[model samples]
Target chain A: MIEVIRSGLFTTIQDLGRFGFRSTGVPVSGPMDQTSAAFANELLQNDPNDPLIEMAYVGATFLFNKSATIAFAGAICEVKLNNEIVRDRSVLKIEAGSVISFGAMKEGNFLYLAILGGFKTDKLLGSACYYEAVNGMARMSKGMRLSFQADHQQREINLNRKVIGLNRNNGIIEVEKGPEFHLLSEEDAQVLTQTQFTISPQSNRMGILLNELVEIESKEIISSPVQAGTVQLTKGGQLIVLMRDAQTVGGYPRVLQLTEKSINQLVQTRFNMDFRFELARESA
Target chain B: MDNPTVRKYGSKAILIEWEAVISPEINDQVVKTAQFLQENHSDGILEVVNSYHSLLCFLKEKADLASYIDICRCLTIPISELNRTRQIWQVPTCYDTSFGSDLVSISNAKQLSIEEIVKLHSTGIFRIYGMGFLPGFLYLGGLNKQIHMPRKQVVKQAVPKGSVAIGGEQTGIYPQSSPGGWNIIGRTPIDLFNAELERPTPFSVGDSIQFVPISIEEYAQIETAAKNGRYQLKSVHND
Candidate 1:
């Protein structure tokens, strides 16, 4: 068992997120940076979808109530265990009654702490992650305790072994123009692909509100059902990319849809990060 | 009647999009298309979600989409019975000062008496063009022309669940508590959304609804019943 002594900025448990429920307005509240989550698991050799701790830019602190093996990955953070400096992005063994603290990150945002056996939390709506607004799994709070079950088939890795590397988050995303792609003028669609949009301050799990670079001519249409990755054109003509937590239906015209791979990139962006899109690969 | 412009959505889905605003005619075709594909779709197909003017059908990555659409082409769908299947649900609303927050503002803006506003709302047969934005959040078309109002420019911090409100030309319940910008005219005690239940959405597309008047005292009883998860709107009625 581990007890959180200090909760950092928006720390919570997350897995691969709830899928197939976007039509019902449930957001996939999983680790924001899935690539790093996958990479952490790959280094620990844990299977994909392993439940882990997702934290905002500032990391958190915890007292190990019991002996356990844990690893940290994703956005690089300054870390210490029992007052002894520890390395980030490496698996380590900490005995019971030890305090672990993670200082603020110098760059990037969001980090993952993966336990060897994975954090044990009650699954909700088929997702291990927590939904803040709705009743979701436990968020990291003072005096909170977390238990992990031993994977009977756990693979042993060397604690002294290190595969440490630090890299700032960098990536451009791809998307397929969607249900309303044809509705846009040919020049508009061409401009959309050729344009670069910055993530607006009004971004969250539901979707990223993007700045308007090109004026999209929207034909007034009735509202309809939407899905994650659906880039809706608000009446004001800016695009809002509906994400895992997005509403099932939207009145905005869907101009583009981020490919699943690209969606992963946008959600994990650091402050002030910008990305441009390429037209989706046509079917072979 | 199928439009000629059909296409694949992605590796796992196909889309049938009608080229017009939502109409009973278009909505019926969407439902029939969903039913036909669900009945005739081959292995690897998982589910079909019907939209007001489109049908999004999911298939396995391995399933060839062109072949799936071909199979869809072969399906002989019985023309939709949307006009007949549409049920009028009379929702009892208590829009007195205690229950309706924006009624006074609405009355002032629309230049109508509260009683006149309620009467017009109650008489209108709003269309359930689609169910979305939230679970059981019915996107009702056809607000009384007198009641048609734009949404609040800024969303409220928190809107109570079951808020009967208007945004642009549509009216709907909040379904659950969340931030919203709609102009709330009244509230009901109905729980339009529940996660534990098998079927979460209370209304399906193509359904029609009417608002029935209720008193403050009845609102209290209904609200208590809803808190205990025992309230049933019993709203469906013959048109």
Candidate 2:
């Protein structure tokens, strides 16, 4: 068991997400940076769908009551296991009663910590992902005890995976034309691919509001199914890129749909960071 | 001769758009397609979300595009043969002053008395057009024109669960407490979306609903029963 001593800005237990519930109007709330979370699980030799401690901006301090093997990944954060600085993206065997702390974030916004057999959190609707609507709690709080499998035999494998850090040079996000992409004028569409937009402060798991505004023709479609990575052009000319916890359906016109890889990259982006969009035609 | 257009929503989802406008025919097609996909292609399909005129099929695996398209084309079920099982749920609402703080305000805006407003709202048999914006939030159509009011300029931080609200040309019951802009006129005791139940949401798209007014004392009785899981929702099969 790991007890949260000091819950940081926003820390929650998440996996891939709750599936088979979108039809019932539930949002698929999961980790923002799935790529980084997956890497942590890979290093620990755990299932890809294992639950993880996803921290944003800051990270929580945990006291491991039971010794376990774990790994860390995503946005460079200063990690310390009982005063000894640890490296990211590598496996480490934590001793019982060891204090693990995370310092200030260095690169991106989201971080992940994966254990050998995954956290044994309560699964709601087939997912251990934390969604406030489903479980009534969105993030981990201090004094919360997270349970994990204590089978020491599971960590006997000789698994030493290479460290995979965030890609710093990739500033371009790829997207496909949305169903209502043709609603925008040619120049408006071109501006999306050409102009650089900064992430606004009013951003959460639902979506990120861009600082740059492109004048779009006012159009409202009948409420339709929308998903994560859907770029909606609001009537006020604001561009919103939906994130992991976005609504399943929306009334605004969906202008573009970001690629899955781009969504992973975009989730790690910090507030006020500038990025460009690259259009890739849907091959169907 | 009315075939829906299929397109890729993202890497792991396919969207079937029936038409731009909302109609009974379009809704029937949307619900039918969703049912067909859920019944036939439960293999790799993760979930199927349907709106007023569209259905999004989220797949669990990244299958080949050509093969998946072919599979989707083969699994088509005719609208005539589709499952038409639907229910008309009778939801009890308490429109008392304590439950509906905005009722008098909405009454004044619509130039009607509180009793008349409740009478008009309770008369309409609203159809569930979609389910979205939040979990189990049924987007129902058929709001009485006399009681139609725009959404509040400033959204409320949180409304209690089962608040029967009216926004623009639509009306719905809040499945769970959340931030909303709709003008709350009443509250219900029934659990529209209870996580403890096997099926969280009680209603689905294509279902019809009617609101029945109740006193605050009765609200307490029903609310207690609902909490205890003994409250039986009054619903009947619709032909």
Clashing pairs in 2: none
* Model 1 CAPRI rating: acceptable
Interface RMSD, one decimal, each candidate: 2.9, 0.9
Top TM-score prediction, candidate number: 2
All DockQ scores: 0.39, 0.83
What lDDT would candidate 1 get against the real structure? Answer: 0.72
Model 1 spans with C-alpha error above 4 angstroms: A41-50, A132-143, A150-154, A158-171, A235-237, A281-284, B36-43, B60-75, B78-90, B235-239
Per-residue CA lDDT of model 2 for B1-239, tens digit only, reads 36888867788888888768768778978888888777777786778899998888888775565566667656657756676778999999999978787898998897899999999999888888899888889988888899889999999999888899999888988888888898999999998876666688888898899998999999999999988878998987888
lDDT of candidates 1 onward, in order = 0.72, 0.85
| Docking outcome class, model 2 | high
Cα deviation in Å at residue A159, candidate 1? 4.2
